[model samples]
Target chain A: MSTIGEYIASHAEMLEAALIQSLPPQWNVPVSLRESMNYSLMAGGKRLRPILVLAAAEALGGSQAAALPAALAIEMVHTYSLVHDDLPAMDNDDYRRGKLTNHKVYGEAMAILAGDALLTHAFYSITQCHKVHGIPAERVLSITEELAAYAGARGMVGGQAADMLGEQGLTKLEELEYIHLHKTSDLIVFSLRAGAHIAGATTAQLAALTDFGNAIGLAFQIQDDILDIIGDEKKLGKPVKSDEKQQKVTYPYFIGLEASELKVKELTEQAKKALLQGGFANPERLLQLADYLMQRDH
Target chain B: MSTIGEYIASHAEMLEAALIQSLPPQWNVPVSLRESMNYSLMAGGKRLRPILVLAAAEALGGSQAAALPAALAIEMVHTYSLVHDDLPAMDNDDYRRGKLTNHKVYGEAMAILAGDALLTHAFYSITQCHKVHGIPAERVLSITEELAAYAGARGMVGGQAADMLGEQGLTKLEELEYIHLHKTSDLIVFSLRAGAHIAGATTAQLAALTDFGNAIGLAFQIQDDILDIIGDEKKLGKPVKSDEKQQKVTYPYFIGLEASELKVKELTEQAKKALLQGGFANPERLLQLADYLMQRDH
Candidate 1:
């Protein structure tokens, strides 16, 4: 692995540990609800969102500790979305990450509540971070506002709605782009932008990070689509052909595999360029992240 | 209605208008999620939670506008809990306030997402309120922390879990009290306490209001239990006797209806006394609220 990749992998392991440790105590939740939240949140995945926050903060000359809460908050929000997405009425997936989805394990009611709890707790987490770092309350509030906007109706939820509604037929490239941008890209953008904002980034730097995040987020989704069709079920830790079975529209379905791959390459390059313009002299880690995202086996 | 009651009712009406008018534009959420959130939020209730915040603030000699956002935040959190509770897995209720529950109308996925959105947005609202009121950032951060603790696992969610588990059988009065104290009473207490905090309530006043809130909240729950057994469905505007159908444990179930009614009366008296001790001479509105809780047909 490249040096930056190695660093991210190690950092991700630590971040995951922190996340699991931070989960609501079993005593605090119904036994069933606690089990369900753990089922999804503790399920092993690359801590991509949190890693993005850490990486962005690091790139901006901020300490990882300074960004830890933002990292945790982003992951919490992301996990919440995933938990809700796997519910019977949404993606209806029975299995995720090689195990039963939250609703299947906890029942629908607890699963719903678990997601709500996580989302609410995320903001709670962010506020606590504000306290610890002595970050100006206005800046913390600004970040909260930005994070809410991106993760809420206009951003991720909106994308999921369009995805569900648009499931009936093959979608155009523009529609697919809209879905990726809102669903996948918005939080990713927020994660990076929040890190920079917390670290007192200049307006121009914030704008650049936004562009970089947007490109990488879309590219990440495109790669995910490509993997679903070609990835190994055992390695992917879930069913490979499930999206196809559900007839969900994806970048590969619209642009063909080769075209999607090309788009991923193009977006990766653009993300790198944005990072460069944003005065990231030590772009090694971020560049490796883009490469690793595009080339992941699962 | 008494003059204070008339004032509360009128002010609550105004708060309701502000809530409706203040909903972030539909464009902020995807059309589907937007429809679901609005359906439940705009479906009218007495606006008791927000009104409590306003009254508490006014009583403490703060401007009502200073408390509006906090009031709105409390309602959003309360509404989110309701949406999640009515999901298929939780209470599995089909209707609330005589209208279809969020999941039933919007489908479970959107309902879940909508609830998550509302909870997250609540903090954003509070922060924005602080900004508008020019409250110190540290104060805003502290308020957010207080709000989170009350709403999160140790507060409302914990109560919910106990209520759900206790539904199987809560034979003791204390167990029922524990459940209500956490689930129903904590937020009510938080609502009053948070308002008092924002208004710079004296330490003595804060302690008294906290006591007052705790007494009334339990009384409120006890009255709800009484209504479930004795209330008219048409007047309640929703299903009555649902506790029996759901096999849920309640105050009346443990203490008997007559004892529960007596408890409500006692609690109301305690609440009024606490308010008086807190130096609230104009306890007119609070007394009316206590009475309304015990005597309302609905």
Candidate 2:
């Protein structure tokens, strides 16, 4: 059987083409706005959230075509968040993935607009499930509601706010956990849930996926923190010790590096266990993907 | 037999209460983000868009209770746009409706997060129509789609971008009209259409309202220009001629003051005519609301 890396490599190319096709016509989008939005979106990444969406759907016996729009929508939301976070008033990062950030290439104003446009267009993309794949309107609406819940004030945005606020003071273990849960895990959870909803997963199956998503999401973020200390700069596409330079609180700050690594392994096991219990037609890909994420050094 | 003034005052109070009631609990939203969002939302204005939603629903024999969530959603969208527009990277305004702008009160970072949170939460609010009013999933999904279309990159955001770009060069009357049509009329049209959709308006009826919305939306904006040059400062709650100070292109800039005033009257007449042609259980309130908007100094 092919490894998860082979699966990801094949699917990522499909996603890249689908994203370009999904953009509204030039007449619909203004010339400069379209250019700015495309600039950041076309910049490549791991496509992790969207890949999770496809994997979950496939595990539940759904077609990838049926899940493509939702996968695209979630990616747009993720991209928009990154764009906004890199703004001068926010994280103010000059680079992402070894490339100049959205605001660096486009002006701050256009970057802000590009982010807003991407976020808004994400919902528009979700609606395409009905047109493109014949997903029921009821199911689409449910997905839309859940997406807004996870992406909005009470979800990722709230977490970013908490993280920013935490920057001014000492962040306790519990507060850091809260930030990680909302800022990272919430969207991850939504990605899984959206894909499962498209596949008509039962409530119990959805619960299992949620648990699996939460565990892996936290593990993924912890891995990010651990990588900051010991990761290769060329592989990471940015310098190591960024959290240290910023004096940012991290898992490694609270727990020792070895303990943090242990936590990631433990969470990965928990995630795999949840998936095994999920009773899917095929969970091998997801199980392997979880292991793959944990084993990655970058 | 009461005047439109009384109609506005009575409905405005109900809208104010509903807006406050619609906010998510403190636990769901971070403290600073909530404060920044509420700061701009509660800064009172005429409540024209939400009221139009109610008016259109009523005209088609629908209950206000059934349309409140959508009304609230549109208002949130409008308020979020104002917040983002007031950012230092954008319009850089210090005040809105005579109160400190969101960024002025909350730091720039929180203000940006607040705007993002608010924009996202608007979709969450729209979903409430299913829970609060028992609107069907299909209808709600359609409303959600239309809302995204009008408020998204190709809609209001596109208009804002065009307006910004127009600042660099001489703006012809056609370009100015394009800006006003999308920037102002699109949301107004959506507001009316949303209410009509909730009320089960026919295709013809929706078309009539769209026409009416476009005419009055332009007229309303032109009135803004006229007021900038000739309006009372206290009534407007801000300095007059600020548009002139910015050297912004306005209707009066292209057509001259006397012609601009005549244009408002002409468009107002056309709007009233469209409403008269629209078949509805009751159109008196909407008809009067249109006139009220035309006659307002602020």
Candidate 3:
């Protein structure tokens, strides 16, 4: 049996190919804008969000081929948020995934446009599920609606706004939790849900996956915070204490590093419990994946 | 019988109400972001795009109610492009429609978030058509796809990118026309197509409307260029000759003013001819709108 690491790596390679296939570099207009979008998109990462999408589909007995577009769309949305968040007006980061950020290589205007293109293209790309994979129009529409909501005003973007507003200082645990829940978890949750939706998971099964998703998503961010303190900079491909440099509040700062690490363990156990309810052909991979994420080093 | 002007006014009023209803002021998380979106959205203008959507639906002998969500979606898209275009990194405008621009009122981060919110909300709004007006899931899906294509990377956003890149100045008339055709006309064309799609227009009829839309939309931009030179500031509700200040390449700047005006007249005639072939319930009204747009000062 393949280990969880191999499962993730295999899925990530498939996702990378799909993403490149989805966005052609040969569009007539927005030539440079398209290149800018490709720049950050092609930059390597774990591809965790998209991997979750495919894994959920497989657990529900769905082929990765059938679920690929939805998976790509979710990743595109994730990528767009990162690009925009790195803008000068936002997080203003200079690097991402061990490379210069989108704005650093492309001009600010082009980076902004690149982000907009990816976000908008996420919608356009998903519509192809009906065309390419013969997914029903109603299902595609439902996905589109859910994607718009989670990624837009009330979810991820709203979380970013709160994070930006609180950058000077956030004292309340609730406020920081809100940021972690919405900014980071919304899309992660969406990716899991979208995969199940493509695989025709029952309402109960979907609920289980959603619960699993939310728990693991929080745990992932907590691990990220933990990494920012104790992680190897070379392995992480970013500065360890950059979050501190930003003067932003974090889980470690609020609850202490030990408590934050404890929270990751708690959330990981909760995710395993949820997946126990999400009955499927082979949920072992998913359960293993949860364990792996909780103990992730980089 | 209501004149074309009265017809437009009636549609605009309904559109205003629908716009307000579609975007509630009460999204709690993105409070300031939602407010920034509402700020420019509620700032009064002619509401031409939504009106055209309704008009095209009516021309196809369909209920305006069926097309209303799409109309509102298009308006949201237009508003988003405006908010972003006015950003500090872009046009850097302080005013829009006689009021402070979103960035000026809400700060740059909020304005950017607002634009992102509005753009995402557009898709969410249109999904309601199936539930609210009994528009079929397939038809709504088609509209969603077209809107995504035209308003996104290949269309409106692409145009905006081209316009920004040419801020130093575009020399060729073709370059200026490319900017005008994509930036200004893409959404307008989408509005016309959306109304037709909702009404189930025949292939020939849809093609004719698209032709008319392309012509009239480009002409609208040309007239806008003329207005920048000769328009009343109080009436237009913004600074005049600001395009010159931005060093933007305008139709009047590329060609002599006389030739530019001549092109508008020619495009207006071509639009009327397209409407002639369109075979609608009241092509006369569309023709009148074309002529009015050609001659409008503001």
Candidate 4:
């Protein structure tokens, strides 16, 4: 593709097809359960995490077909997190992406189970990397372990727990960074690493990608906070400044908006530097992706 | 170890220690998240599933050291299910095993995240089969896939969904059986198969154990239904006839108490016969455990 947008568009098509094909057959799952899972999985988002998986793999000379399952798996994990986070017990969001949230559409019970089913099935989907896509079992095992570590108690869930606890009155900058680093960055890191592992990247290369992912993940979050404060309301969808309305502590809350923007630039530059030094055959797309994320308004 | 009770006592102690040790160190996990998980995990159940993993491995001449991680993993999955099942939007229970339910103590949000953390960590725990316990990578992969299958949409979650939908008024025996088979039997079957895979049991032996697991799982459910009606309240740790009080359609509700008891006996016999024909090196403990389950009043 000539542009990052084109690259995302084409890869998203394939990712959508792969996601549908990857679901267990209707006969195998309960009708309502399958419906609830599909409602969330098919809900439109940026599709950034899975696309990162595909781009990272392609950049490392891995075939898209080989990385497709991991791509879908990461998206499933993301979808499950969203589903749970939108529950009445959590953020209690009624809508996401202009549609009813999972718990709002389905009852809380089914939504809870659907989120769970999605989480568990994500691992099952990853196993297909070995079972169907000809990836080595050891590589698949490593990917599975990486996913569990990044998504489990000490990673995304821990970040969420900390964030929730922080919401009660804590205002430390370190705690906010911890939450952002884990709740947002860990899965992004996992996506890149999973794809790189599929391509048999060396330790040095994986470390480089980890640096790239961490930098861009933080940049992405900071940019999101900046947009929430200053971006066009219509383009962004929903209202801007919702964070300020809720008195939520964000990057801009601790640091001024100009500083937050400068930090995003610094992190994006750091990410590009890591990729340039990693000696990959095709880092162009990943470089473009980091820029696309940094500059996007929505 | 001469009796099933003694065998269970010793195995329970070992399983308890393993469960605690298998947890990510306190420093690695968030304090409150760890506390929520530990609360439910240590609240105590029969520890039946993990013990079964140990016993099955022993039957096939595999060491307990090799099976312990898988044992810990299955119990984590079981504990997570209970934590979510007790949520206000689900069963709405305030207590379990004489302790406050997870949501009751930690609040609904933490309870949900804690359950999510436990479920994710279960897969992480299973990966230790190869990492710490020296089981083959391929075996660990298989065990992980089996866990996702038996616990995911097509298995326990599917069963829970069906049971919830059925409570709207459907009372067919077939539907009830479908719910019980998937919800109860799948995990039991996975427990046996995980141990068998660790032991390097042949496909035939795995199939035989599956049959044994299915028979006992259903029989065990029936026994639960029967006990809910005809057993002592104090021994059972809850009121007797609670299912009847709720008008829940259980085995005895549909088949009559006499037929349900008869079905339990026949299923137990079938389970024993499968073990006898399976050519395990030692089936003594599993056999005694089955009979012990059959004869238990509480």
Candidate 5:
């Protein structure tokens, strides 16, 4: 088996290729709406969610083909969130991944519709996976249900709502924790578990995977907070200290930088351990992913 | 058997009750976001899409229970579209169904996310149906794929994009027709066809249903255009001449009001004939629905 880094890189490239190819032809959408969707979706990013999906599915002894649709679906959902978040009424950022945000390029209305279109397409993409594999329809349905629960108001959207409201202030560590867990962690956890579920992971395996995802997800967020504080603006490719400027509640804000870093390290280790317990044979990629996430300047 | 109108009304009430009941409790979302979703979904309007699903399923001899989840799924998609449409970036409407539009109440950001969440939840709802019926897993997967296709860009979203662009100006009648067929007709057609698909309708029956749905869908849009010109705002519960004021293109604009009205009558007759050819029993409700659509004050 390839090293985890190599596995992730190769799969990431494949997923990116699929995403680019999967986009509706320019003729398929209005020039304005298509431009908006392509702008954000194709904007350069790490494709982390898709990578997570691929890695988890492979870890569960599933074929990459079996997991490709889910990978695309996760990316679509992620991209949709970013597009909406960039709207004038939301985060109102003009740039993302070092380029103009969807609304900035396509106008707000087209951007809004583009995001809606992408999100609706994500479900369609997942539903089409059954054609690739003769996997039972029940499994597909369960995966769809899980994705919805994790990404909807009860999960990601719920978390985002709290994050927006809590931007004013989060008095308690638990409240901050709740916001991060739902807004950020839930979708990451869903990505991992969904891949495993589609690959038919045993219940025990799924539980372990969920734990691994949760730890990494939190660690990932903490690292983000730390990066926002210390990272170079050019390297990060977006504003630094913007959270502080906005007075957004964050881990480093509440726990201090030293404690936040420690939490990241501990969570990374815990995630590795969980993967090991699951007898995941190709642990090198995920291990590297943990390190890359924590150590990256961006 | 119940008269189709009686069956439709009762089923609509049941579906509405289920929808209200299914909303995430206040505990689940920040009060603001929860209010946004509920505000638009619960706003009084005919539950036409869900009713179509129930009617189609019944027409194919399927139990209403067997089709309820699909019914809910269709409504969610419909509601999501409306929320997105009302965004400042989209149609910028301030009211719908005689109530404040989603963005008007929740602000654009929450409204955008609310729509995203609702669209995501729709897939979840459909998957739950599989759990209830123990339907073949493969069938569930297929149904999900079909539903996604009809609701996503290649269907509804694709149509919407064209509509948005066409509103600026459609150069040709065919271009205008394409926009209305896709934007307005696709989901309506899908709503009618999906229930029958779930019910295991015979190939011939499915074909007939598709024909019936397509005719009605187009007819419905034509009626909408005619109403925009001649209908009373007080009865319609929306601004009657708003489409004209916005310079939005409509069938009436392209074909003239008299021709548009004639086309609607022709298509309505065609729809009824298709239902007859499909051997649809108890189609009284379907006929009444056609009448109601054409004659509706609002």
Candidate 6:
């Protein structure tokens, strides 16, 4: 049997090839714009959201091919967010994924446009889902709307605004959770839901997966906070304690490290419980993936 | 009989009301982000794009009510583009429509976030198209995809990159045309096409409208160049000669003033010819709007 690690690696490789093909053709206009977009999009990373999308679809017996467009789209959205969040006006980070950031390579203007293009291009990507797998236009449209809603203002952007504002003032635990819920969990929840949606999962199945995604996403973020405090630079692939340096509110900071670790454990268990309760034909791989995410360091 | 100016005025009022209602509700998250978006969206302008969408749909016998969601969506996309385009890293303008720009009223960070939010929210708004007018999910999906593609890298963003890069050196007439075609014409074309799509315009009609829109869009832009050179800044509601200040190339700069005026008249005639040849029922208003756009100072 293929291990979850192998599954993730294979899927990521598949995604990489597909993403490359999606770039503007050589004869396409504005070659430099496409290059700037590709610079950040093709940057190496775990491809966690896309992987989760695939896993969710597989567990629900959906066509992975149909889901591929959405998978690429979410990754694009994620990559765009990273590009924007790393701007000097935002996090001001010079590096991402252990390399110089897009702005660092392409300049601030190009970086901004690159992010804008990626976000806009995501909608174009969703239209391809139907063409690739013979999915209906209506299904693809539903997916398009969902991706935008979660990634847009009322969700991720809103959370980001609150997070930035929070940096200047002391944040309560409730507000921080609010930020985490929208900033991180909403997109993760959308990923699972979108996968299930592609496969035509039942409403209850979709709800359960969303819940599972929420728990795991929250756990994943808390683990990130823990790593920021204690992870080795080589393993983490970026500087640690930058969150502390920024005086940002984090799980480890808001609660003690021990409590935060305990929260991770609790949330992971909750995720597994949600999956089991969902009663899919086979959710073993999803369960394993949840466990893997909870323990990952970088 | 209502003149074209009166027709435009009534449509603009309707669009303004509809757009205001689309802003986030009181309980929505990230109050400041919505404020920033509203600041730009509610700023006064001609509302030309949304009006075109509605007019195109009307000519195709589509329900205005059915087209409301899409009309608002195109407007939102237009507003978002203006906001981003006016940023310090882009056109870097301090004012639009005779008022302070988004970045000027809000900070640069909020302006960027607001633009991002507006772009993302447009997809969410597309989801409501079906609900508003019984427009089919499949049709709405097609519209969503079309909007993204035209507004995206291959279109507007690509043009923007070219426009920015063109600033660094002397630009050829062909290169300047490329920039204008993608940057301005594509979205305008999409706006007309989207409206037709909403009303189930025949393929021939869509193609004709696309050509009509293209002609008008190019004409519209050439006139803008003319205005930038000799038009009053007070009426234009922004600085004139800024394009020259930025050392940007233009139609007037490339071709003499008399020749540029002749070009606008030629293109306007082309737009009317497309509509007539396509057999649009009651093309009078569209024709008038075309003339008005050609002659407008602001």
lDDT of 2 by residue, A1-298 (tens): 8778888888888898888766766457778988888888878988888898999999999977989999999999999999999999999999988999998987888888888888988988888888678898878888999999999888999999999999976558889988999999999999999999999889999999999999998998999999989999988888899888999989989998999999999999999898788899988888988888887785
What are the candidates' interface root-mean-square deviations?
Answer: 2.2, 1.0, 1.3, 1.0, 2.0, 1.5
- In model 2 chain A, the worst 10-residue window by lDDT is A21-30
Q: List, for all models, the DockQ compared with the true complex.
A: 0.61, 0.79, 0.75, 0.86, 0.68, 0.77
lDDT of each: 0.80, 0.88, 0.84, 0.89, 0.79, 0.85
TM-score of each predicted structure versus truth? 0.94, 0.98, 0.96, 0.98, 0.95, 0.98
Off by over 4 Å in 4: none
For model 5, how does the per-residue alpha-carbon lDDT over A1-298 read when each residue is reduced to its tens digit?
A: 6765566677778887898766546435566666677777789778888888877877777766877888899898889888888777989999987898887777777787788878877877786667767655666777788888889988898888888877779999999888888878888888888788778888877788788888888898888889999988988789999998988878988889999999999999898888777776555666677777777664
State the DockQ, from 0 to 1, for candidate 1: 0.61
Per-residue lDDT of B114 in model 2: 86
- Model 1 per-residue lDDT at A239: 88
- RMSD values for the candidates in order, in angstroms, are 2.4, 1.3, 1.8, 1.3, 2.1, 1.3
- Tens digits of per-residue lDDT for model 3 on A75-109? 88888888888888887889887899998998787
lDDT of 4 by residue, A47-133 (tens): 899999988898899987888889999999999999999898998888776789998888999999999999999999899899888
Clashes of 2: 0
If you score just chain A, what TM-score does every candidate get? Answer: 0.94, 0.98, 0.96, 0.97, 0.94, 0.96
lDDT of 6 at B54: 86
Task: Tell me the lDDT of model 2 at A79.
Answer: 91
Query: Which window of 10 residues has the lowest lDDT sum in candidate 1 chain B?
Result: B21-30
Interface RMSD, Å, model 1: 2.2
Candidate 4 chain A weakest ten by summed lDDT? A18-27
Interface DockQ of candidate 2: 0.79
Better of 2 and 4 by lDDT: 4
